[model samples]
Target chain A: MNAVRRRALLAVPVAAAVARDVAAQPAVEEDFAAAERAILAGRTPVAGGIAIDMPQLSENGNSVDLAIKVESAMTATDHVTAIHILAEKNPVPRVARFALSPRAGRAEVATRIRLATTQTILVLAETSTGQVHRASRDVIVILGACVDGG
Target chain B: MIGRPAAALLACAALGTLAAASEIRPSRDFLSPELRAQQDDPSRHPGWLWVEEGEALWRRGEASCQSCHGDIAGMAGVAARYPAVAADGVLLNLEGRIERCRTQHQAQRAFGYESEPLLSLTAAVALRSRGMPVSVAVDGPAAPFVEAGRRFYETRQGQLNLACTQCHDENAGRRLRGDVISNGLGTGYPAYRLEWNALGSLHRRLRACSLGVRATQFDFGSPEYLALELYLASRANGLPIEAPGLRR
Candidate 1:
């Protein structure tokens, strides 16, 4: 066979493998996309002014401590208005949403949440001036030994 | 060179000293620093969710725990001394005692084992005893039960043919897959286990261990587990209770 034809034949299998992988992407990814879109509400969220504090490795997916902080001036005119948490791979990607005001004094919240698997978590914060900021973190959740729930 | 008897005596003495030097460490010490910190902060601790439920349950109905016991804090040190022989001579762990109170005192139905209300109330009560040393009595009427528990701990059972001592005693502080094996102390139960994602009793944990070893899983409040709970508590004699503890 000609060298060009041989290379083209090899590329066909490689292309098929790539197509297979794209088709094999989990449905949860689409779930996350939809959830994120719902939260964004047609507005683009800029990546910054927000931070997520959580363990990089979680011993179990059951309950993980998470904290989100948004950089904002706590004033009536320039405060954080809301915070939304999204887990990219959880059955329900929307983890929580907290509505706040200048009365909150700070755009910080800490809580324990369940992660369905090892996945990226996104945090979005909305300011009083209609600006949206975002941050994300990846957590590796190890499966528990006794998950039979016996 | 020493005589045979003298050599045996020396060996025994060495073993005794080794046993004496094995300090009792809380399971929290085995957890990652992040989990350890989670256990300390109520706002960040999922166990507090159960404790909060327990607090509300404590005041529910006319025959509430608060109506009889006044402030729940008044029961401090009570959890630290559980798996004790009750007035009626029945050996009872904290959960058993709570169950008894609900049924006999409150004229209510049994909450059954591992029930949410039971776990909540047990955790709430145990939270009050946090930092107090576990002081379950292994003597008196509790003697036979404790002895049975010790036997259960030492005996090799299940398909794995492993005794509790094999791992928790001899191989503690070592890795068991992705997790570290902790010294088997019950001080931190009615703890919130990340595995269970909820607060659970030491009995539930014991049942999980039984299942892990492929042994006969006992009922939640079985006498066998009650005896085991007493023995474990006695072993933990002076370790501070970390009930509603966060555990992996």
Candidate 2:
């Protein structure tokens, strides 16, 4: 074969493989961005004064315990109004949203969530002053055995 | 310093005692520290969701579990003595007994095994017995059933041609893929399994194991599984029930 023709033939398979990998990339990023935009409503959240406490390594992706806290006095004038949880790579990035007020006594919430895979979990706490504080933690999820049984 | 033959004899003696000891450990002992912590924390444990559902079911109607049993706290230690022969002479596990109550006493249709409502009620009841040691009877009318169960445990089955004892008894604590092998104890039932993302009965877990070995998956509440449950409970005698347990 001619030199240019041989190189073109070899490049075809490599280009196809690369295309397949690109297609395999998580397509939910756009959905995640849209969901975040809906929650933030054009406000830019600063990353501080909020914390997410969760295991660094999760044994399974089915149920993961998560806890979130924000620094606030929880007063009527300066309280956390709502907390939004999002998993960047989940089919639906929005995991949960909790509405709170000064009556809640503390700016904290805890719950369990299902992780689709190893991904970053984002937490957003909106204060009464309309300021949004953000925090995120990456978790490594291990697939469980005997998953085919059911 | 010992001679070769004497050292070999000593090693055999040590193994013999280890087998005879048959030290029973709770399945939680085999969990990662994070999972173990999750199992212990009521707020964090996913099983509590089922427990809450169970409590709601307990008081749903006039012919409710609450009306008959009064306070749920009164059920403490009840699950520890289950898998017993009922007055009708049939062996029944906790789930089986719950099924009978739904049909016979309440005049309600069977919730069917492994249904969310049934699992919820069973988990609620089993929760009352948490921390209490298992004490199922293996003698009297239970003898034959226990014998059958023991036979099943010892005999090889399925395409894998492996018995329960082969992995659970001989190779427990060893790695099976990414997971650690557990002693196959049934103290935890109607427990929360992350793989299921819901609470499941011991029978469901057993059916999964059967499928894993390419064996015949038995029906829920089948006599064979009931007998095996009895045997497993007896094997776990004196081990605290960790029902609504957290498992991956």
Candidate 3:
């Protein structure tokens, strides 16, 4: 019994160390890749004309404010069609989708969302000309939200 | 909308002779410039989401709050006087009142404290009173609760052996570690806290403070929190309500 207890105590730290290592490893990037594929289809997105505003470090992940803007004249010929926000690791990566028309005057929208943990958020804007613009930001959340909301 | 000059005059008139004697500054004054700007701009403030959700819940729930209240316009300045002594003599804050109304009048299930729906409803109700003054009554039945809260604020507790007064009253405007401590006011609650990265209630912050002092933290809607809220409201008397306020 004494030997087993000693072994168990020694194994606990090792198990914890291994668990920490696994947690430290970056999550598979495939989740975002799949999400992007679904949104963009076969279109290759360029990383310009889209701006995302979010905090670099969030003390709480329950309601992080997100703002997205796309560079456009917002005229009949040139206007943003839609803006899609995605969280790389949330239970559902799709946070929100905003559709806009030229009447909106500016291609911008802001709202709050929940983040499950530290993850990259992608904001993609689709313009009338079939041009897809994308922006990504990494946010570190100290306490994740929506985990216990039943 | 009431113009600035007229509003100021009305405030003065309402405050009466002793208005100038109180140290009354909105919590916006205590925040950093960037945070203050965020609070001022509705587009940038995240608390609006809760308000929006709250507005929806008010109209659509099982027993909609709007059914009896009709348009919510008359609710203005109602939140500023909350944590008040109810007709039954029990001290109740906005959340408590919401629960009571749900159970008693609405004949519906009460939203648990700290739940999203509850927070949203509380924020919505409190938002109606935005820009009003903190004016909770500390007289009559509320007097005992106020005394209890005052004692809690002044008494030292926990491993740190520090009272709420030590930091909020005596060391206010001073730096502790990296953050500046302001006079612990309950105004601007149901506010978005950058540190919380979410909208939180006065009780949530009180629990945080209790934990900070290594003291016993109470449940969300506990009597301890109610008493503390009343005391904080008294401390913040005269400060304009900035519910759905942005805080860092």
Clashes of each: 0, 0, 0
**Candidate 1's DockQ:** 0.19
- Tens-digit lDDT track for model 1 on A49-111? 987889898876656789888999889899998899998876667889999989999989988
In candidate 2 chain A, where is summed lDDT lowest over 10 consecutive residues? A1-10
True contacts kept of each: 0.34, 0.47, 0.08
Angstrom error of the Cα, residue B68, model 2: value is 5.7
Candidates sorted on DockQ, descending: 2, 1, 3
Q: Where is model 3 chain A poorest over a 10-residue stretch in terms of lDDT?
A: A1-10
| Docking level for model 1 | incorrect
lDDT score of residue A3 within candidate 1: 16
lDDT of each: 0.78, 0.80, 0.75
- Second chain only: TM-score per model? 0.91, 0.91, 0.89
Candidate DockQ values, in order, are 0.19, 0.25, 0.09
Candidate 2 is scored at a TM of 0.78
Report residue A112 deviation for candidate 2 (angstroms): 2.1
Indicate which candidate wins on lDDT.
2
Position B12, candidate 3: lDDT: 60
lDDT of 2 by residue, B63-131 (tens): 998888898888898888888898779998888888898889999998999999999999999999999
Please give the C-alpha DockQ score of model 2. 0.25
Give the per-residue lDDT digits (tens) of candidate 1, residues B1-248.
11223323433656863363256577778889988887898977889999999999999999999999998989898998788888789988888889899899999998988999999999999999999877776556777887899899899998879898788878889877567888888888988876555688888889878867778889989988988888777667667888888887
